[model samples]
Target: MNTRIGTIFAQEFRLARRNLWVGLATGILGLFAVVLGVFGAGQGAALDADALTLTAASLATLSVYLIPLIALLMSYDSFAGEIERGALALTLASPVRRWEIFVGKFAAQSLAVGVAILLAFGAAGAFLALSFGTGSEGIAAWMRLMATAFVLGSVFVGFGLMLSAMAGRTATAAASAVGLWLVLVVIYDLALLGSVMAASDGIFASQVFPWLVVANPADAFRLFNLALIETAPVAGIDGLASTLPFPPTVALAVLGLWLSAVLALGIRRTKRIVP
Candidate 1:
């Protein structure tokens, strides 16, 4: 890109590297992926499927719970922490546009997390490919898993940045990040299920439940990847995937929309940061 943004991106990436906790958390996730890939059959013979498919399934389950949380942890303090310490004032004094700083930091945080995911999935993929054969279909599925998983994570990176921009305090931003994760990944789905059960045969279950699942990036990510493998079912979630209101590609599109919308809000807030 242009020299200005490029410089900002490089600087931001360097700054992002200074945080080792992000690397450690994601490394632990990658370790889990490898463990799940290599030994998933121990869980049950029924689950003894293609290593890649099993890897994807196990990871889909794990990531919906972990990726968003980790993404939020990586980004929760991007602005608020700096601002809390009066560092943002010095940053604002610099010649760079506020939007550029926010965009650059966002890109850098995303890249840092993305690379960890790439490595995590890559290790599992290598094992799955070697054990299951390097057929195009299997390879394609693995690639799709990585892409979808990363998109799912990026949605929360945006979430974290938005919280940081709006909260203006590191503690508030951190707490909001965790709260948002619980709402989207856990409480939202549980509440939706409860509503469907409570309103069984009502228009809410018939007309709204399916759309509501797609509305949460977490659920959309879960269904899309489960559908991708056509798993031969994680606690019956494959059935949910089968019943997706929209195509799997549309879930990916929804994820893209979430990331874009949240990042836009973060950038707008950045421009208004007093210091």
Candidate 2:
């Protein structure tokens, strides 16, 4: 809210926009959206009605991973990269508070990623409507998908900021962020599958497994989105046919706690670097 913070926020936005990678990533995602939309349209004619619904549901499900990947890419360099280059110290030496710096940087990164997602979804939705003449239900489903994607993106951005704040170098931060994504979005599920396979039939189906799955941010995102879009049955997730009661509210609370804690740690870390 202070002028100093506003200045830092503006600087962050400028840096993000000027970054070529940001531009490239945005363009690529936008293109992907258009292509997916076109595919959705083409499949409408040949596919049975129920099958088309499934396809849309699947695409919505896939967005859980898609949005987070994009957010991770945007935030991979939020803080550590500057520190690595020896610029972070000079930046911190300014009159602005460390929290201000973190908030500004987070906002800028979030805005950039949000824009990319909006563009992608808008293009995709428009194409689907124009090509297939999808009706009100289709539009409503897409809206739910968009809402879920936003939640998913916010979770990742918070996570990426935390990783960036803790890392010592740009490469380490980037690699760690990507590795975390791999584990959460993909490997974690595979590991769970293996565990279930090994156990076959037991209490594992109902008790600890459900709790363990919620602990995973990716799983939470998947469950929340799947629930929102009414596609949980399609995912064939046994036992967890839908997200638990109040899962969306819980997800938002958990994500906010993570973000606030990380930002606090980051500011503390920054303060120590100088004081």
**Highest TM-score, which number?**
1
Error of 2 at 140 (Å): 2.5
Candidate 1 wrongly placed segments (more than 4 Å): 42-48, 132-134, 236-238
Against the true structure, what is each candidate's TM-score? 0.91, 0.82
RMSD (Cα, Å) of candidate 1?
A: 2.1
Best by lDDT: 1
Which lDDT tens digits does candidate 2 get at residues 111-174?
A: 7776766776767667667756766666766666666566667668767877887776789989
User: Each model's C-alpha lDDT?
Assistant: 0.78, 0.67
Off by over 4 Å in 2: 42-56, 230-275
- Over the stretch 1-275, how does candidate 1's per-residue lDDT look in tens digits? 65656777787677767767556766887788878776864543475456677677778878889888888988899889989999888878878787787787777778877877888788768866776544565567678778887888777887898889889999899889989988998899888777777884767754677778888899888877877776536663336677666678877878888988987888998888886
